[model samples]
Target chain A: MASGRPIQLFRNMTAKIAAIPMILTALVIFVGGTAWTVVYSFTNSKLLPRANFVGLDQYERLWNTNRWIVSIENLLIYGICMLVLSFIIGFVLAALMDQKIRFENTFRTIILYPFALSFIVTGLIWQWLLNPDFGVQNVVRGLGWVSFEFDPLNNSSIVIYGVLIAGLWQGTGLVMVLMLAGLRGIDQEIWKAARVDGIPMWKTYLYIVVPMLRPVFITSIVIIASGIVRVYDLVVAQTAGGPGISSEVPAKYVYDYMFQGQNLGQGFAASTMMLLAVAIVIIPWAYLEFGSRNRG
Target chain B: MANPATISTAVAGADTLPLDGPQGPRPRPRLSRRNIFIYGTMLVVAVYYLLPLYVMIVTSLKGMPEIRLGNIFSPPMEITFEPWVKAWAEACTGLNCDGLSRGFWNSVKITVPSVFLSIAVASVNGYALSNWKFKGADIFFTILIFGAFIPYQVMLYPIVIILREIGLYGSLGGLVIVHVIFGMPIVTLLFRNYFASLPEELFKAARVDGAGFWQIYFQIMLPMSLPIFVVAMIIQVTGIWNDFLFGVVYTKPDTYPMTVQLNNIVNSVQGVKEYNVNMAATILTGLVPLVIYFVSGKLFVRGIAAGAVKG
Candidate 1:
């Protein structure tokens, strides 16, 4: 193939021509764009990007900013809680649905329907539901618990949790569906053997079945992790980083600085941090899945 | 144990049953403890999942007078379509008092072209990768899929520059390009896998018949891949329609998509906080995806599953 003439490029020219858009998007947009953002992060470009170098200055400001710190804190709380709760709820729902119960389709349709709605819709609905004035607090108070205080949206400290509730409501359905598929893929003989051995169903699940769904779990984690990093719209629709920016997230921070604040340097730096967060989540998963496959 | 009389009758009638077996399948008592436990748990979960939609519908149907007096979960005493009409025609987002209609039409203009263009490009690209097997096609494909994992923020500004440089910035056409670029990876992967799964014999036969790459793709591949095309359409339509980030970033206030506009309408601060109108707007924004989800039930699951497993 290397010894071919200069006309070798024209050999499968139609194929290459058909592939120009994919090639450009893969190389120019994805690779080129990411590199551009990282490079611009080092500069002091305010409204427009420039080559004026100011290494570490933007990063310093980003770290020193109170909103950035709060954003990180909110992301940590939301990310950790989302990861833990969604997994538990998803796996439990999947396991329950695995039982030979009736109306399986109806239950699944109901649970998974939420996944269809956009995060914006989910956030707004949840914002309404969590509204202190006439929402859950009012309902509970109307039910005779007049001292109920469930208004996370307006409360600065717990506003992130309000966002988390909506996030979980929208996303757990997908996780449940993924886990259910994984459960269905398990060999029935394993369950039969466990039943014959008198092992409890939960034990059979925890001790035996879960380990087999490692790939599914890993996939969900990567999906959810990347999703956690890109959680801008949900926050925007729900809180708009309100109650004094207590619910700020990195993605929103980037958007505000770049577009809203017109501070391109800060936006670039903040988005670079987001890129780093995604790399942290994706790198190891990529290595585990692809690296070992190459070696084997 | 719950039905002693039925058990006694079955036992009494045992002699009349086949000697080989009692029956093909055993019938469990519906009111058994285990059945009750499972059904009760599922019922509670289903209600929890369905609560938001239920609340949205009930709230949208009621007047503000009733909403002020009642809890959000209560059914409307007198249902009115006034809120829906208001949400569609009278709600304000920023300076636009024309409601979600502008956003809705903007989204239609954005989504229709985007879905069609992205699918067309991706399907052809997938065909080339699967059948033609150029020297470095797989390398580019790998990078494309990896690009999907990189946060869109990383690429957002650079693409802004790119679009601006190309004289398409802040235009509907530019937003369409952005959608196509972002949707490329998953759509391409979907098509690649689907095309690769097709029998190679057909391609080989076409090649032997003197069909070139475009000829074989057009004649053999396109007709056979309709279902995958529908799956891709489903994925893209919902995805591009529900897109708030790209629409907000790329387009001006006048051309915001439904999701972005819906967010603005509900969260805009100056308003007197019309809860009924807000709920109505949200449901209206969500209605497209919801309709597609229910209409394409199993296909929707398959689309998401394909997307999920692409990792």
Candidate 2:
């Protein structure tokens, strides 16, 4: 045993050495990429990167720009609307299905199928359905309701809600799945107890089941929130941030400035701001979740 | 045997008591007007959830003339397979006027290799972290989890730059590499969490039998991980197949994924809006992932639920 110690130690060292490359690659890609972006934010880059440092001018311009401000505000509205709407709709659907409804799998599939499609396709379908001249609105008008005026796509003020509808359709399926999983995990004895106590179904769901599913709810919220921050494809595919950029979100704004507007510095600055914002929100939540898990 | 007889006697007594039994219903019928009202409301809600898909199907079948007539719910006046055929054969995506059919091979090419490599690397990493217990394993896992939360949009610019420097900016290989990198976090987290959940006694037994790390991982752990492995493959396959941004950014025109073709075809500003063709193309682009989702729905849900509940 004493003689074997040296050989075992050598084997352990060799294993550690083997893992070094994997660890280093992950660190380099994440750390190196983050550093590169932060540095480029300060440079006078355009289309392609040029190495001239430009101090804080890009930051200054980003803050003062009206489009940037609007985009930020729009993202806040879009994010909140999408999150709240998807959550409520998903929860209700999951609850209904959990009631042992007929065609449970079929209904679940119909709801989840939208999630399988790319946002690009869903956005296009939505755009078509909402178009003023050739969509549902015109059809409604053709039914002799001359007073109907459903044209959110053309209305700069309310168009983001139109986009939010499409987003909700795609996202609610994921929320439903998460909630359904949570619901299925609940003990049947709890339901029996609740029923014996003369508790109604809705009241039981609201008080007992939903509270039990809090962790799942939080997980769903985090996933949906991530999608909100990265909501570019839908905007591009549907509105192209049109009707005078009323529906513009920060990601689209950054893409435009980076590629189309030829202002990489400003774009990178905006990206930095986005990163900072996400970190601010996520870091604390992650700490709570991960920290609590580890400590226990 | 005595306990069983006593339980049966108790059940017989409860059944004979009927209304006085512990499982007896309320004095009056509980489900009244309010219950019917609630069920009615739920049914309407279900209809609302299903309406858009109904419209998409109806519209896809309608020709331009019927579509222009603007009856979303009505059956098509002249239902035809023309649009589906046109979308597959003749739709104009760009300077290349051919349909989205051209991108089918490209998507398969990118998705197959990317899925295999990502899953393989993730399995290796998961094995190392779970079994090896190196000094920095916790820190490495923490960073990887954090990486999962960072929006892919924020990483795009930097990734593009890195790819360009490495001479992979506009190649199909580059896109595959990017997919693997982005796919790593979730895949690694999944397998690592799964492997951690497994019986440590098995590993101890394997070690006592003179098994090395690779031997245990390959012969013991990996075989036990088939269910989670299927789930991981489904997620990666669907994600990579339906990817739009990476496909658009990293791939040359010759290698555009079906999504990019669908996007260009449906999103052209100056071209006439061909709703039929666009719908057909959308359906086509969505076909593979949809099929996967349907077939693997149960496994996918189980896998995600297990991972989420444990983590």
Best by lDDT: 1
Interface RMSD of 2: 2.5
Error of 1 at A41 (Å): 0.3
For every model in order, what is the iRMS?
Answer: 0.8, 2.5
DockQ for the candidates, in order: 0.84, 0.50
Provide the RMSD of all predictions against the true structure, rounded to 1 decimal.
3.7, 3.8
For candidate 2, the chain B TM-score comes to 0.87
- Candidate achieving the largest TM-score: 1
Q: Cα deviation of A217 in candidate 2 (Å)?
A: 2.5
Candidate 1 clash pair list: none
- TM-score of predicted structure 1: 0.95
What is model 2's C-alpha RMSD? 3.8
**B179: Cα error in model 1, Å:** 0.2
Candidate 1 local lDDT, A113-146, one digit each (tens): 8888998999999999998989999999999999
Please provide, for model 2 over B35-127, each residue's C-alpha lDDT reduced to its tens digit, 9 standing for 90 to 100. 565467666766766776677777788889888765777877777888888988898866887788888778999999999998888877787
